[model samples]
Each structure stands twice: as structure tokens, then as C-alpha cells.
Target: MATLDLSAHLKEAKKHGPQARGISDMARSLVGSEILRIAGEVKAFAAQGNKVLDLTVGDFSSKEFPIPQPLEEGIIRALKAGHSNYPPASGVIECREAVRQMFERRLGLGYPVGSVLIAGGARPMIAGIYYALCSPGDKVVYSLPSWNNNHYCTLVGAEKIEVPTRPESQFFPRAEDLAPHLGQARLLCLNSPQNPTGTVIDRDALSQVCELVLAENKRRQQAGSPPLYLMYDQVYWMLTFGGVTHHTPVSLYPEMAAYTIFVDGISKAFASTGLRVGWAVGPTDVIERMSAILTHLGAWAPRPEQIATAELLNNGPAVDSYLAQMNRNLFTRLGKLSGAIEALKGKGWNVDCISPQGAIYLSLKIDLRGKKTAEGKLLRSDEDTRKYLLEEAGIALVPFLCFGLAEDTGWFRASVGAVSLADCDSFQARLTGALEKLS
Candidate 1:
């Protein structure tokens, strides 16, 4: 029998740190699209006429809600004009300039052109910031029941500290909870008009958080620690449904602009998910580093897409008409869904939900342990109810389990964004029927 020298091979493997070991470790720790997978299966079942009334993913259904007409035409023209080559790595100058202008005009914040980088979506923008700012074993703080990608802290070799929020406080992390962690935190992730739960962080809450972040960063610097970084995932920036005033972290704290990275794009507001485009704004150094990283990953976003996007922004009237219609369409659906959830509480389900001020989702609570129908049947976990709803009542919902939640809970997320206002009524009916049947 021949014995191989394993130690020599292991030493050779360790030499490829940044390229192989680091990134591979990052990949392994990151969570994949668990919700999307369930959503896909339900969609397949629906297509097969299984009577699946899916509420699993956040997608806007094609109904009276129309895609922006001008952007579509602009894209066609750009493609026909032969603008198919690789664009500048940072992003096209025109798009970057538009982004800077939008920030100033809309949010009242100013960012220089060199401070922006365009990516496929907010996810890539997040990944770029993590790569640029976090080191192995650094701590990153965020709130729970958040977008599961907060798990990416581990991917960047950073520790994830979750500030568990309460229902009474609207599930937002308070500054007091964050202050203790600031000394060790390398990054903080804030998602406004949050995914799953459509709770928009109130302006006052943001103001308090900004003050805490700055004060704590100053303390940490005095103690000779690295400054804490802030990644604001404002993907639903322009998707406010009700009369809520949207707040930007960068706008709230310009001093923290050096540490703050803002993620935004056209996916939610413009319904352009298939376009695979988004942009980030941060410090010049941070943008430069992330752009280099993106270049190594992919040369650049398609040139035609950038040109088309610029045209859409530069043309005011067409975009305004689209935005107006979209706001009306979204609010109509969200109002219907909120009313449905509120009505369920009277049925002994004891469900509680917050009306979404922005974005498409409304996170609802079902007291699994206490839930009972007038008929006296017990309600179990969200997954069990979801299955019963799908198989028996023809309704589909993404269970809380898919969002990295603990067991024995009665929370689930439904998207009111994709479905039309009329379909949302049907969805509510289907859901009501399922709840009634369970009892």
C-alpha cells in the first residue's frame, strides 16, 4: 500500500487564498433563493391547472398595470442603433450623471459621478460593498425577519448580529439596540420598505439611527477601531404606496456618506426585473474598488441597456405618466390586501398586519398556537396551513420557513404587487376560504 503525503497537498491548496479559498468560502455561506424556489414550484403547479392561487413571490401581474412605454421604445432604439458592446466598467457616464441628479433632485442628497457604480441588481451592489468593506471575522449588524441575504455577512467572513425587533415597535431596530454592537460592527444593513414586511422605517426612526451610527462610529474611532460601514438597501425607494414620506439614509446623514452605501434601481419602481440593471452610490474609493471587482466578475452591463436607461430618465413626461399610473395601481392592490388581513381578525384567526406605506408586501401574523376558526379546528405552523391552502383551498403562500425563520411560528409573506387589484380581491377570497376551511 502506498501512503500519499496529504500535508503537502493541503499546503498547496491554502496558497490560493483570495481567488479560491476566500470566494469559495463566501459562496458556501451565502443563502440561495429559497422563496424563489417555492414560488417556482407553485407557478409550475398553477400552469398545470392544479388550481394553485400562488402568493409566493413578489411579482407584478400583467393586468391594467402597464410597463413604462417610453423605456421600452428607448431600449428598442438603443439596440437597433448597435449599442451592444461592453460599457465602461463603472457605468456609462450618462447613467451615472442621471443617478447623481436623481439623488439630488428627489432625495435632496448630492453624490459626485465618480461615486456611482452600476450592477445587475441591488444584490450585486450589496455583494460588491461586502467585498470592499468587510474582512473575515468582522461583525455586521442588521435586523431580523430581514431579507435572508443578510446571511451574506458570513460569505464575507463577517459575523452577523441580528437585533431582534418586536411587533409593538413595528419590527424596526432601535438605536439603543444598535449602540451596543456599533463598537464591533464593520457594517450595518438597513432595508426600507422592507421585503416580506412592508414596514417603511419612519423618518424619525431613521434620524435616531443616523445619530447613533455616527456617534458610535466616532467612539469606535477614538478607541482605534475601523469605522463602521452602512449599506442602505433602498430598493423600493420610489415604491411608497400610502402617504408615507420616504427617507434615505445618505440624505439623513451626509457625514456618514463616506461610510454609507446606497443601493437603488429600476426593478421595483419601473418593473424592469428582466433588464437586470441597478446602481449603487457611495464614496469614490468604495465605488472604484467595487467597480474593479465587478469588472473581474463581468466586463460591464450591456451598453444598449445603459443607453436606454439614460433616455428613459432624461425623458420626463413619459416616465411621469408611467410613475403616476404605477402608484395608483400599487395603492389599489395594497389597500385591498390590507383590508382582507384586517377582516380576518374577526374570524378568531387573531391575525395582525401593518398596512404597507410603500412596496408590494404586507407581512401578517397568525397566532398558530392560539389560532382557531369558529368551527374549532386548530391552526398549526405556517407551512402546514400553506400546504392545506394549496391542496385543499387552491391558495399558495411562501411559508416563513423559507425566510430562515424558526419553527412553530405563524408568519408568512404575500406579494400584492404583481397581481392586479381585481386579482388581489380573488386572492383575498381564496385566502379567506382557506382560513375558514381550516376551522
Candidate 2:
């Protein structure tokens, strides 16, 4: 049977009438990921057969950084065993128990399995958290340069209380800075071994923030208002380095457990992004609410991957061995990039980077604003700086502006996930020649 060609009608509909506002207000207003948009451009640039070292997406190149061997084997085994059915909305019971046991064994935070709700990676958990907790116009306090808090707030129609952080504090919000925002906010978000910046919050600083949360909850109790919730996205908690340790609110103060929800997954920690297994650990009531939200969206992890991840996380020795090797490889990659950037700084270039502490990123500042390119065009913004580097040096990076930074900050995130140490070393040679053309 011949199908009617509807493309012309659909195109005409878009030019006038209700099709202009056909999408729901929320869907229409939602802004897509800038990080992803830039990553797409980088991919297109590389597809042209250019010698570009892409450091855009916080994603692993499976060739260089494969998922743990045990996890891979388990996935194959599970698939062979016919574990292909839809998993329970909350996840497989075994996997939830495994996450609970792993957290207790590894992070020293013990909780019943019911508090854990599994989803298709951590993104669903974040969206579920926003959907579960926030009403329109409620305040959500998150740090600047945070991963996706702004987008989440917009999705849920929450008021954003942006806490701008300085480089001195590693782009982490101080307790004092967060205190004023938390009093009336519905949610407070924190990330450690933080994305984009690769900075870890010290124990003392984290403790103070925990204390602030506790105090805020107390005020809420007296005022007969709902208690504030804290969503601690520790997806990169396992990726710390350089003698810095990762700390958690609940780990510091057990009282904060009532208000703190931990979002974690194998995606970042185990280099298993494609596995689609992650869990939220928090109060049972909140987890249930989040579960309801996710269930409607069908956001549970795949059964085979969940079963395989359970097997992986439950084995302490395997997890330890994988992390040890993983950290060494990541350390080497980060060291190459950091050394090259620092060398440029030493040569009096307006460039700098925070020493890598954790995560697959290094906070690099290519502060070339106001400088004219060799083509006699002035670099006016981070986008200009990004394009200049890509066109000149063939080095691709994601600017911090993509990470909710609303200014012309020179900061960019250099993720060492998709490239090799050799690819990283190439940045210095490429960048040094590129910078020479600047006035």
C-alpha cells in the first residue's frame, strides 16, 4: 500500500495555527543540555577527519577505559540466563540490596534496602527528585558550575537560588554562603568530586554544610513547614585523587540522613555508562515518591545490567582492584593535561587550571578574552575562545558556561574520558602554537 506524503502538511501546520504552541508549556520551555550541544559539534568537527582531541563530553571511550571485567562477564552471563524481562519499577531486589550493602561496606552508611530505588542511570534520579519534591515557585539552592541543577529546576518550575562560588573554594559553596539560601529553599543539591571542576569538598567544609541542613530542618519543624531535602549527587565520589578524600553529609552526621539523598551509579564509578544502572538512597517516603515519578516514566534499569552490577558491587576485591587501576590511568591522563596547561601559565600566557583532585575533568581557564586572534578578530567570550582553540589548535573542550555558568567566565572543563594520555599531551604542542597567534 502506498503511504500518503504528510511532510508538506506538517511543515505548513508549523507556519501557523495551534501547531506553533502544540507542545506542553513545560516541554516547550525546557532547555536542552548545552554540554550535549557542544559535544555534538565536536563530534561533527572530528567526523570531518580533522585531528581534533575531543575533551567535551564526560563520557568514556570504551577502547581506552572499558567497564570492569567482572561486570562485563556478569552481563553476558545474565543475558545468557534469559534475564531479559522488564525489571521491577524500583529495580531488582538483589540489586537494591547490593547497593545498600556496598554503601554500608564502602561508605559506612547503613540503610535498609527499601530506601534504595534504582533507575536508568543518575539522570532519572535527579529528575525524579525534582518532580517528587518541588512545586512551582519552590526554591532550589545549587552551586554555580553544578552539572544540571538549573535545568532540573526549570523542569520542575522551581526558583533557582544560584550560589556563585569562587576558584579559591574550588567552586564549592561554603556553609555560610548556603545558609541564607537553605532557610526557605525546598531543595539543596551538592556534588562531590564535582563534575566540570574536578574538585572535592574537604571534610570540614562538608560537615559545616551538613550542620546547616540540620539547622534548617529544625526551623522548618518549628514553623510547621515541610523539611528541606538535600540531593547529594556523588556519582563521581569514587573517582577522587591526589590525596583528597570524598566526604558525605550522612557520613559526617547521621542526623543529616533524614534530609540527605544520595544519587550514585556505576555509570561514573565503574565506567559503565551504557549499563544504565543507578540508585537513589534516602528516606523511604521520598524514595517512594521518586519511585512513583520514575515508574510513570518507566525509568528503571535494565534487568540484565542490574543483575550484573549487583554481582560487581557485591565483590569487594573486584571493585577495589578495578578502582586502583582506573585511578592510575586517570591520574596519568590528568597529569599530562595539567602539566601542559601549567607550562603555558609559566610562559606568561593568560591560562590556568585547578590541579586535578577528582573526576575525569580538569578546570582549565583559557583567559584570552580581549586578545585579537591572528585573523585580527577579537575574542570576546568563552564561545569565541572555544572556537578559536578548536579552529587553531584542534583541541576541543566544553566551557563552564555549558555547566550553568551564565557569564563570560574563561573556565572550561577538560574531560580526559574520551581521549588517551597521548591525546592529552598533544594539547600542549597544539595549544602553544595556537596561542602564539594571539596579540
For each predicted model, how many residue pairs clash, with residues at least 3 apart or on different chains? 3, 0
Report the Cα lDDT for candidate 1.
Answer: 0.76
Which pairs in model 1 have colliding backbones? 59-418, 60-418, 61-418
Candidate 2 steric clashes: 0
Q: Which ten residues in a row have the lowest lDDT in candidate 1?
A: 366-375
lDDT, candidates in the order shown: 0.76, 0.91
lDDT of 1 at 362: 73
In candidate 1, residue 328 scores what lDDT? Answer: 81
Cα RMSD for candidates in order = 6.3, 1.4
TM-score computed on alpha carbons, candidate 2:
0.97
Best model per TM-score: 2
